[model samples]
Target: MHSFTVQQINEVLQGELVGNTTHSITGVEEIRNAKKTDLTFIGNRKYAKFWADSNASVAIINDTIDLEPGENRAFVKVKNADLAMAKLLEAFQPETPVFETEIHPTAVIHETATIGKGVQIGAHCYVGKNVTLGDGVILYHNVSVFDDSTIGPQTVAWSGTVIRERSQIGAQCIFHNNVSIGADGFGYRPADDGRGLVKIPHIGNVVIGNGVEIGANSCVDRAKFNSTIIGDGCKIDNLVQIAHNCIMGRSCIMAGHSGLAGSVTLGDGVVIGGSASIKDHTTIESGATVGAGSGVMNNVKAGQTVLGYPAADSRDMLKQWVALRRLVK
Candidate 1:
């Protein structure tokens, strides 16, 4: 366990500290569950209301909130308490798994594959012919990099990740367990004789930019013609799906269970809420926010917020809801 004095934690957060600075914090916990030796945070009024009853030794609080540190408890006031807590948690993070050797005996590497410096290939991992793994790449156990694929420097693929042929992933990207990149897109057409469906071949690949992090079990499908591109700094949540030929601009955020159909386009900084689905060929401009559970069938203008089953302007949807409630009354 890691331990730090109230004063030391305050310095790390660079926040204003009030009350006792000598108390020791052994770990972090939720506001309601915190012990006397634990540290916690109050990011909003909901949590701030419980401060007086919390037994935590130190609490990081948002500067916008007006609260006092009671008795021996200390308060580290910052502009954003959540972000401040993130820094401390990173500092206290446990060590990650280290490879026993750079290349494990059970791993398979093709003679034509290019392995860069500081790469670690774990047991049962496979690097196919013509695959290029850049410097500092780490492939955990059971990971597979198929032919002609290229992974950039410092990229990490955890256990069970599969990078299919011709996929290109950029630097500092992370693929969590069971992530599927360059998977065949879901496409089929009715046969000429109407006997059965004909599968449409996904002949292209997936191109992901730098600093992208895909959560566990997420998938990015290969394109039908050109690459399905994910711009730099996008953060994808677990169980999300990006379908064939989808193009995402920089820093887009997709919540858990959200999905985009084939050829959907998102501009920079678009935020997709949980379980939201975008129809195929739809375009969402930059800074647009799609509310949770929304089914977007039309284009969303830049910076607009949409809501409802078939998403509409947030204000319009709210007005319609109000009218319905009045009718019920």
Candidate 2:
């Protein structure tokens, strides 16, 4: 545990100190789970009542809120308590000692592949032929990069993330555990003989832009003949399925369990709530919101907020809700 005086924290975070600055505290802790010698935060107004019996020595809080405890607990008042706590955590975080450059004996690398400077390939990681990994990229244990795949600079892939052949992922992107990109899309036709279905070959790949984040267990499939494109700054939640050839616009938020059919286009700043299904070939303009559990069946113009099944206007949905509420008699 790293210990710092209350005065040192006040100078580093630029917060006003209302209690003893000479007191020393070690590490950061939540208000509910705090112990002695720890710095706790009270961001929620509901937790204000618990401050009287708080076990921590120092409390980081806002000036306007009243946390009138019987005992004197050191208070560090700031504009935003949550933001101040984040800065304290970032400063006291323990960093691992970096090792000097050396390749392990168990790793195998192709002679023709391009490996940039300052790259680390951990044990049991396989770098295939014709694959290119940019600078400062790290492949952890048991990671695999297929042939002709290009991973940009300073990106990290957690455990068991498989990048298929010929796929392109941009810089500073993060793929969480079990994220599958550039996989074969679900496309099949029923056979005439009634025996089985025929699997259609997916000739295209996926193109994910920079600053995109995909949650765990989500799969983005490649297109049948065109690329499955995820635009820049799009944040996708866990278990979301982005089908083949879906062109998502910039800065859109897709919540959990939401699935889009093939070739759908969503404009910028669109927000989708949980478990919404968008129909194929539909175009939703910018700043539109699809409510939770909505089934979008048509193109929604810009700045529209929709709700319910086949998603009507938000005002209409609320009007119907009021009329239905009185029918319980």
| lDDT (Cα, 0-100) at 276 in candidate 2 | 95
Best by TM-score: 1
Tens digit per residue, CA lDDT, model 1, 203-304: 999999999999999999999989999999999999999999999999999999999999999999999999999999999999999999999999999999
lDDT of 1 at 265: 98
Error of 2 at 281 (Å): 3.0
For residues 120-166, could you state the per-residue lDDT of candidate 2 as single tens digits? 77666677789898887766655677878888887666667777877
Per-candidate TM-scores read: 0.98, 0.82
Q: How well does candidate 1 match the true structure in TM-score terms?
A: 0.98
Q: Model 1, which residues run further than 4 Å from truth?
A: none
Range of the 10 consecutive residues with the lowest summed lDDT in candidate 1:
17-26
lDDT of each: 0.96, 0.82
- What lDDT score is found at residue 154 in candidate 2? 72
Please name the candidate that would achieve the greatest lDDT relative to the true structure. 1
Error in Å for residue 246 of model 2: 1.9
